[model samples]
Target: MKYYQKALYDEMTSFYLITCDDEGDKLGRIRSLIGGLVRKARQVIGQEGDDKVRIHQLLQLFYGDWGFHCDPEHYFEAENLYLAYVLETHSGMPVSLGALLLYLADSLKLPLYPVNFPTQLILRAEVDNEVAFIDPWNGHYLSQAHLQKLYEGAFGFGAEISSEELERADVNTLLNRFRQLAKNALIRENRNDAAYRYIASLLRYHPEDPYEIRDRGLVLAQMGCYQAAAEDLQYFVDQCPQDPTSFLLTAQLAELKDHFSELH
Candidate 1:
């Protein structure tokens, strides 16, 4: 299997990798690592119910040596390493390292969740039962105010947000991330056809999202297929009437259609 395909399959079957020995000897090692970690965590926490401390330690044990960055690709590679280690050494499989940490945290009754950053991987921890962002790779704790600053730096003004609003992201969101990476790979390889196919798959998974529609339309436009672009942009406009870009695309399409009509 291709690397990404194997990664996807590993994500899907992560839960069983701990026990399924027929897959490979690596599974046994992963199981042992996870088991050892869990035991150590329980001993350290020792029924004190200090979930946050326990989770922090567990994650540290897994990835404290790694550096921190705001880049999504860096986080992806980190997650891949963490998950692969857990899967091959501890009989642990998490959909991703982020998911694995979330799972382990959950098991420890820690209120930890994945943060859906626009282009980064982050986690939120309920320290003292209050929400806070954490840089798992670097052990940097982010305050709500800091998060707002980060958001402004990344997304800009008028982005509606609140600490309470940033709920736990799900597995599907992580899967979409993988798909985004796949799309990027296609682009890097100059395989627009494959890139378009990946975008179609993304739309299938997130049909109601106008952003995907707009993105797909932009890709179609780049390919010089104005008709297809118009179709997608029209849908995007229909779905997100307030987005100025969609309106602009619609106007561009109208002008193209008129020019084509004149020629015909």
Candidate 2:
């Protein structure tokens, strides 16, 4: 119960509760899940005072005994965003899986932090003054070369992994990434209403963010909120004139206005 760890736990739990539509005790359920893992992890790590050994055991508990893994086939499934669903199904995309790993690492008193890496969510672990990067999709340790390869894959060849890219992400940063991922997944699945909810939530946290505004506009258009979509798209085009997507949105705005005029 360090202050930062508790704050992160509470924030993540609150976000989970906010996303649920049913009447169940989402907080309690999440607490129970983490509590069970904590107990089991403690049992496995008993008398093993080595931080490295404890980390290995915890990974075994998570990836081996508990069977958490990435589900690549249905990569954009909206259900993969929830911790409860990921815990139950043992499969989730990177963000949810990374969050779960960070939470468990906190409970087990391991020095782990979330890294909001480009196009992936990863963890940074500190053991005995040495740092290691972990791929949360699986509990594999990543070398600087491995991370460089990932960075190049995302940003094209010759891109290098920078210190900023590996910096520890604060809780707010992690939550923002989670919501963005959720929004995109929902949009990909054609669940426009759900996607809109995520966009709205992000907007409340980061008012008038141009990218989110654009995403909101896209979701609104899909849901037939043409006027709102047009307004949002217009705002984005006006604010970010040179953005790569702004030109495309400019065209979309013209078409949207035409469609609106036709209706009128």
Candidate 3:
């Protein structure tokens, strides 16, 4: 079972949460596969000098040898977040694949890191006094001009990208992005039960998130978990007490409380 860590959203743990059930019945197999992959990666870099650790080598290993690539068919499917699915099938959306690749890079002591790009995940590392960026989804170099083109392509001509958008993202941002991917997929498929679980996971890592608190409460109520719904709504109301939406949420929480009391 993935012992729920309420502190920070860990990469491996988050993968476990998405891919496996709470019991994680299949986690052992997943871990074994990951161990073997890392071992192979380690062997691939055996006794090589730091300069030899180039992005193309990584591309060859992950894409050519390991065969990891984007799942174009199910680009945003919630199942792509499952690490086991990615390992076995070698396909996922950018964030999942990027996150896993970044994690593996870190494990191997590579300087690779995740970057913040609008609606897309990317990787970057400092090499020889210059920063190198890679698009994990396709293993292509991500230059500034390319990033601008990608931005405008995804978000019309008026939308532009700058240094602000290219900053390196932290763990919390990665967690939110990961949760958002699954949350969006679940909500799209009308899987409120699973969506609520992901919302709960988001709150664990970011308890002060007012939007998530409000959304989670709404989802909880939809799933007939009245008490939890009320608590989450109340938390949201407390966090953003000045927000006009909180007043409406307050009324809803009051109604939910009354319903909960009668059921006791």
Question: What digit string (tens of lDDT, one per residue) describes model 2 on residues 1-264?
Answer: 342544344544555565567644665776788788777877887634787887788788888989988977977787777767776788887777776776667767787787889878888888888898888888999999989988899999998887987978766776667666767777877887667766777688779799899999999998888889999999998999999999888888888888888888
TM-score of 1: 0.53
Task: Put the candidates in lDDT order, highest first.
Answer: 2, 3, 1
TM-score of each: 0.53, 0.89, 0.76
Candidate 3 segments exceeding 4 Å error: 1-9, 50-53, 204-208, 221-264
lDDT of 3 at 218: 80
The lDDT per prediction is 0.57, 0.77, 0.73
Runs with alpha carbons beyond 4 Å of true place in candidate 2 = 1-15, 23-27, 46-48
Whole-model lDDT for model 1 versus the true structure? 0.57
Best by lDDT: 2
* lDDT (Cα, 0-100) at 62 in candidate 2: 85
Better of 1 and 3 by TM-score: 3
| Superposed Cα RMSD, model 1 | 8.8
Model 1 spans with C-alpha error above 4 angstroms: 1-49, 66-100, 103-110, 117-121, 127-130, 151-161, 166-191, 205-211, 224-226, 238-241, 251-264
Question: Which is the better candidate, 1 or 2, if ranked by TM-score?
Answer: 2
* Clash pairs (backbone) in predicted model 1: 18-91, 29-89, 29-90, 30-88, 30-89, 30-90, 30-91, 31-90, 31-91
